[model samples]
Target: MTANLHLIPLLPLLGAAFSLLFGKRLGKNVVTLVTCGAVAAAALVTLQMTFILHHDLPPGGALVDTFFEAPWMKAGDLNLSAGLWFDALTAVMCCVVTVIGFLIHVYASAYMEHDENYTRFFAYLNLFMGAMLILVLGDSMPVTFVGWEGVGLCSYLLIGFWFDKDANATAGRKAFVVNRIGDFGFLLAMFLIFYHTGTLKYSELASHIDGLHNILWLGLPVACFAGLLVLVGATGKSAQIPLYVWLPDAMAGPTPVSALIHAATMVTAGVYVTSRLHVVYEAYPQALAWIAGIGALTALFAATIGFAQRDLKKVLAYSTISQLGFMFVAVGSYVNGSSNYASGVFHLMTHAFFKAGLFLGAGSVMHAMENEGDIMKMGGLRKHLPHTHATFLIYCLAIAGIFPLAGFWSKDAILGGAFAAQWDVKNAGPVAAWFAMHAGKIIYGVMLTAAGCTAFYMFRLYYLVFHGKFRGTHEQEHHLHESPARMTVVLWCLAIGTILSGFLGVPESILPESLHHFGDLLGEWLKPVVGVQLHEESAGQFLGFAFVATAVSVAGIGSAYIFFLKDDGVRAKNFVATFPRLYRVVFNKYYVDEFYNAVVVRPLRGLSRILWKFFDEIIIDKLFVGGTAAIVNGFGKSVKYLQNGDAQRYVVGVLVGMALILRVSTHYSAAHAAQFHVDQDGHAVTAVPQNDAYTTNVRFKVEWGDGQESDADSAHPRGLKHQYASSGTYKIRLETTDSRWQTTASRSETVVVR
Candidate 1:
């Protein structure tokens, strides 16, 4: 069964290829069947793997099956191969991705029925699922990156599915580019891991973390830098503070895409990575602190912005960011010398259920209202779309962290983890421990406040969309109808998940004494992989945190009811009027996007324009390209005078050359006569002087074009002979010099050396 793990991701990849190749000819129904059926089959395989891991594998054991391996790349001592890994972690992720992915696919079939490019949409969706599965199940970071980049490409395609619209296309590009920033961080981390550990395999890397810490680059530990870089990548993928701007804009994509990618799978990749490499992160406490701090801040920041969003999906988008921040907090918080890795993954699982449900419900609402997305323009929708309203209400409660729902259990666990996180003042010196304790308290407070804001905003959206009188035009009201049964059925199934998935990770304090060990089931299941014992808090402490969480959620919901349900928007108007400046800031998303444009984007664009104008246009084009052309033209004009094609001119040039050679030869023979004496036979004779006080040795050498050189010698003062190794044009030179070597002259002529 473990050997069949490859099928989990391969099935969807094959489906995507088949749909892309034959979708148009196969027609919509066939394409839908292939797409949905493929994901469903993958989901079934994942379920079987999950059962095998739970029943067959021993406690604290993993089944690693190398399905197949091909050498991917080798650098020095490091080798990477493409393969699959199956364990508790992979099993959980596989189930979530394929199961929810199948639901989204089924929902999209009905939602996108009228679109002409329906097959194309399904193809992209299938590709996204396949890539997401690869990302989850990859045995090495490099293999994970293949899926990472694949999902990024599929995200770009799906986000801008309607490329005809400029806004949609721009949104897609923004998501792609912003994610690239994080991908670069991921790449750097992988390089550093390989550099320090000499391996990229997850198992090997984990084993080598201790060895990595002993190695240092510059003044800091290598593991610290690698952990930080991985966090940067995670931030971009998970939609943390700085890189989160792309997600709200990603709402321009089709609703099913929003549900699948933004709400469920892709955004959680960072949490998965953080949990996957817990050993490395545990060694660097400061890096984990940064992760926790950034996550806490983003949760509060996005929750505040969610308070002011009018668009339905935009609110959910910010909510997704906020929820992701909570998950990060869970993963990063090191309470009592251990991080709550399972709590983070548990929240990731539960957030998928409720957040995806909310998005799909919003899609149903939009479908009913003729594609109107503004919740402000929608009201009293419960009468027209009862199924969507019911599912939406449950999801809204789940997100608000109402008791016993998925969000309540997961979110409270995160908050509990934050509360449990404390500094060991006894071990640490006073000053550092003081700061740690105070920072933990501050983080706890901020997360609590963010949780309140989350509940408030979600209920505000709910009341505005489903409770009040119809606010749209009469024509929209007349056209309002429930979504198809297929869409509603997905909503109901997800709502059920929202209601029940909480039990999988029930807090021990809430359970009876006999069942206490059974609580935190997910934590126990994941203990083999994460290698951390779940810390048990006092029952009183658990009840206390649960009470605070429940109170805040109720307060948030009650406040929304008072503002929107009781009064017809008067309280909300009054509140906004009272705090216009603050409201404006929240409404504008703290102008973070604007600030990024003015500070980052505009400057980059300006620099690019300057480079294009001066460097590209003037320097490259005019100086190099245009200069070369001008030089060529000038040489061509100058050489035109020599192309007269006259035989008389050619004879005159030959006669002038012969005259010059005869003059030079006569001069050379006369100058060297003092050193040469002629015998009676009139042969040239050279004399050597024994008393050489007044003589100087002058040497001359000639190079023939055909790879032969005359040796330097004083034997031939006037000229040196050389042999041509082959037939070619040769340059010949002659030299004349006095005994003192003070006066010398040489000349060269080009001639055929055939």
Candidate 2:
């Protein structure tokens, strides 16, 4: 596993490079063949690994990373490794990604064969798979980000693959920009992790946190901030509130690209990031609570929007957003109460299968209908594409959470996790256990209702698309046909995955304790690396299962059947007229996108305009230009004063200054002479008081009051000049115990000879 881990990411990258570079020369068939083959090979390896893990699990064994490195990204004490891991979680994710991704690739091979940019399309597709694989297999937060940003890049490329269409290009740009909102949060959370634990490597970070007592002012705040930041990233990537508009519009791309990126690979990156960092979230349960609340709101919000959408892809796009919200709520609940990564991730895995199947099925219908995506414009095509219809029906049921299907099992597991999280009364301390006992029922009810909403909209979408009269024109109907065999095959494969993938988290009541094993195996594999216990619901979890599973599936399908399958003509008309406001609100998608444009987008653009004007015209042009002019004017004024020529005035000033200097010099010399002292070396000297004047080794010899000179060794120094070392005129004075000395005669003379 270790030896081949790095190869997994590298293989798809090479395939992408090859297809992009030589796709034109090689042609669509060859390009598709090569890229699909590379991913298929990777899928095969992943399946083999899954089987190995399955066998190991039966024997109560698990797998971990074979090897990793610290890399060179060390700063201060923080250490992060740009390494990869191949534990059970990564292994399962790898299998899901490669297998589903490969199927989509195959489907796109035939679906996109006629398109002009076929090579570029496959290039983006392969790049997305490779990046997604790396995201799952990363051993550290930073490594995960590399994969994260990589997937976003691939999604932007693939979404805009058909650049000829303005809408397609716009959709691609929307996806790229919207996802940036989430990516920003993710990056901030990583910074928080680095700041706190000083390590981003899962193993080291997990090992360092212990006893849970370290969570106080520093630790708790950091944990909360990190969790929230990561949730923001999750919201953006998963298409949660305020950041999800791009997904529905993303249908502008080719259908297979839509299925590949929206369903299986790109959008679900948030769920993966949250689940991967579940351990960090556990330390800040308040943040987890917020995650659940926001997730629930988004789930309902998006679900309502799905009900209103006319476009088949848009409905599924909202559905994807809604379903991802469920996953987030599940993860949040797991973190706060149960620590059940298995359930949340189990839902994530099964979601990829069913949602991918659904999206691909939608694509098949669109292809059969000549690229029309609106359900309102499609109908009665079940007869034309039996394989696509059947596969689509299975996927529809699976997403609706019907029993024995993959979605039912995974969805039930999430509800169960949510139930357990609300009140882990059985194991927690006394105070916490007591609160859980009181609030548990309320929390459980909310999650269960969310599940019901999930079923309703999904069925609504199914009814509109697959179970109706042909609403398209005669010419459009003439083009209706089954998807090519290659495309149908991919649909069937995904249908099977959607139907069977739930066994990974099957409820324990149906299986023996020994066989009730999947969650524990996966939990054990992730626990050491994540530092959070993965919990299974304690008891009465089956009641939650039965209630939610039964209510949502029955209510959702019965409504759909009544409205679309039976007497829909009268019922829909009556229902719409009776509740026009409700219908209109839902139909208009609650005006959320419109409101966002009016409030957020419009304001932001206005602010941007203002900033541009202020910076370009006001600051840059005016302040700088005006300041330079002022400086130049000041220089002109200052230079005027220097231009005056007055040599006679300068000479008169010099003569007056000389007279003042002579008077001050004589007074200072008299004051200093009072403390004069003589040395034995025939030189005149003076001893100045420490505070008043100065003391020196050599003293100035000066002429006495009557122009008489004193010899060395005298009681007081007489002359200022002690010796004629060189010829120069020197000022001389004498003093004997007086505050001021007066000169009897003043003479200016030059000492000519030594």
Candidate 3:
């Protein structure tokens, strides 16, 4: 348990570096071997540590490795670290990342066998896993943020692995930019958390955040503001709303990238972070309610979009977005007035299983059909690819929440938790939570309907892709066959996992008294870190809600069977033609991308063009960059003319320069006379010196009417120099000359022949 934690992230990172540098030299096979082996090793260590934690430590115990003997980062009260913590929570995430990541890598070997950039693809995959592990195990927010940004970078790289394709590159940039909005919110939450609590460590924040619930920022609690910022990050990363336009477009990448980044690990980062910092949302029910509402709505919204997509991966893409919404709902629910974020993690794990399986199964279909991603071009695939068909069937049922499959248990837990959650939001200062007070039932209903939608669209995809008569070209039908053993084996493994992983979060409500302890195993494991408490509802009430969840899923499944499988999908097609406008709306994903482009992207781009033209080209380039060079060049040209060996020209240039200087430069003359003090006979003019001028450049002496000179540097004043010119007027003056012109002139402006 005290093992070096750095190895967990470092191994995959090193694998990435090694493969990238030498992968081409060593060949793709060797590169694949090293990258896969690195993850497998990390997975083994994570499992070993998980076993030790389970067997040796008390419930909620964690093994923390600071890596260094002392704290790595500290400044006044703001102490941070590059440490890793392995608790039950981290254990679940680590296993999901490494194990699933490894399988995806293995599957990719066969899936990408003929690709030329095999090594680059593996390198990005390795980098992604390493970053994800760091994110899961980091001991502090800063440490987690480092990993957070790392995965974002890796996603951009992996998603656009085929950079030659414009669409793939655009998809990568889209994900990068959208996540940045989320990351900014996350960064702000970190700053706000530190400002209020003086610490960003999860261990320290548990006690510190409770004190902030009463503190107000604006009109609402400071905790609410921080929680909202964190939720903003979650929505961006988890593909919730507004910012979710990027996830559906991410299908432009290779299938493994989709399965790895979108399905299993990278997209789940938001749920992981929220669950990790669940304490911040604890005291502010309004904040929690916001996340819950958004989650429920996004799930439903994405699921509806799924119903109209023709692309195999696009349907699954929307399904992934929809499922992410469920995880958010689970975390935000915080059921029964207690933190139940671990239930969200439970869904995250189960989702990694079925969703990854589904994506890979889709990949197998594409593999058999010559990389055709459109389900319209695919049907009767089940006949040619039986193993893939069987395994895909299991994943489909599991995702649809049918019966006791993996999706059913995890999704059922979330619905039950959300159903029981109490927002107490009536007292909230924010208007957003007005509907949250006693609104958990409505949220639950929305999630239930979304779950049903999930089943319908997934099966619609399944039926259209697997059940109908061969709709592809005759050449594709002739060559259609099951994928290689390497791929089919991974598919079966994931499918089996989708079946078994659900049992980890089995609700006690459905279990016998003797089996109650095992039913909530995942929840109990997270008790030490999250301390989530489930409300004990009567068995009948819990079972009744469970029945409702199951019935809705079954209804969706049955409906899909009639619309697609029973009548060869004629009804679905007829509905599409009859309701073309409505179908087009959903089919076009409600024009969200177009809306964003018109509203946000187009305006921003137009502004950018203006800035480039005026600010950059005119002000910066023409005025600054070009202006400075022009000045220097003009000076050089003039100097070169002067430096030409012509004496007459030089003499003329100096005279012209003097005349030009005289014309352009203005000169001002100043005259000052000391205050006159009259003598008794009025014959002598005595002068008192004015106070010394307040500048270092001024030093002076006064002259007396006796025609005597005085020391200019002396501190005392002499009498003013004066003589009666006409009646009583007197003036004094000093002589001066312009030596450069060799001319003399009167220096005094007051010398009027006095």
TM-score of each: 0.76, 0.71, 0.76
The residue-level lDDT of candidate 1 at 11 comes to: 92
lDDT tens digits, residues 179-280, model 2? 776888989888777766777766566554432325555535567778889988988888776566667777777888878788877777887777777667
lDDT of 3 by residue, 118-213 (tens): 898899899989999998898888889888899888888877777676546545555666788799999999888888887777777887875567
Q: Model 3 reaches what TM-score against the true structure?
A: 0.76
In terms of lDDT, which candidate is strongest? 1
Q: Name the candidate, 2 or 3, with the larger lDDT value.
A: 3
lDDT of 1 by residue, 1-754 (tens): 3467788889999999999999999899999999999999999988987887889878755555564454556666656676777788777778888888999999999999999989889999999999999899888898789888988889888887866656465456556656887999999999988888877777767678876688777956788899999998999899985677678888888999999999899999999998888878766666788888889988887787777688999999989999999999888778666687888888999999999899999999998888898887988998999999999999999989998799998888888888767643335677878767767778888899889889988999999999888899999999999888999999999999999888888877768999988888988888888766445677888888889999998988887898777878766655546444442344245345344334422343344345435643565446544565678799888667655688787788899999999777555432442332211112211122122332345444444445555534454344334444556655554343443434555545555544
Q: Order the candidates by lDDT, highest first — what do you get?
A: 1, 3, 2
Q: In model 1, which range of ten residues has the least summed lDDT?
A: 677-686
Candidate 2, which ten residues in sequence have the lowest lDDT sum?
745-754
Candidate 3 off by > 4 Å:
68-71, 168-170, 426-434, 533-535, 579-754
Model 1 regions more than 4 Å off: 67-76, 168-170, 423-431, 533-535, 575-754
| Candidate 2 Cα outliers beyond 4 Å, as residue runs | 49-71, 74-80, 164-177, 210-220, 335-338, 423-440, 512-544, 575-754
